[model samples]
Target: QHGTPSSPGELAHHATLSFSYLWAGDEWTFTDARGAVTRVRVDPAIHASNGDLLRDLAIAGCGIVMQPEFIVAQELARGRLVPLLADYRTMDLHLHAVYLSRRHLPGK
Candidate 1:
């Protein structure tokens, strides 16, 4: 964790943290400024389903974690965690808020 990598190629040498519930848990995908896509296969030393746990591990310098910005915002701001590969774009996964109409509600 001393020398944080600044490029996608450097990720292979570092340890990774994977989310067990994510569809592409072991695969990290990125898009460069040139619109080139690169997929990296990471063998995580630790796998977990909880984001909080992964954040904790990353904050403790266990390994790099791919987590939502909201989850690690505080730690990152406080310098407890550092953001890497700022130029590269990762997958944009979002949580959608769904609402059901009365007709679609239970036994309508």
Candidate 2:
């Protein structure tokens, strides 16, 4: 991934990640495949206070928010958030990027 670092002032290989339904809500109402809802937690989202405010919103018992793998892989791996209903079909988006068009203007 582009986030990875190789050596001093150098970049290595790159990898593409994936994203899906970005589920975020101030209040979360979890339900099972049988259509049963469960209790919800009411706490201030820490991540919201930090850089990724939306992340804390999700951690604070908000609705399941899905984001790109690259964007959340670290948080997910660290158990900060849990994936819900993996079997269910979620949303997806097609993203593409190109080199900055404004490059070589003066900072060269």
Could you give candidate 1's per-residue lDDT for residues 5-69 as a string of tens digits? 87877788898888895578688998999989888888888999999999999887789999989
Against the hidden reference, what TM-scores do the models get?
0.84, 0.41
Best by lDDT: 1
Residue 40 of candidate 2: its Cα lDDT?
40
lDDT of 2 by residue, 21-90 (tens): 2453323334445655543432322223233545555666543344556665778899987654453333
lDDT of 2 at 54: 56
The lDDT of model 1 is 0.87
lDDT for model 2: 0.42
For residue 70, give model 1's deviation from the true position in Å: 0.6
TM-score, predicted candidate 2 vs. hidden true structure: 0.41
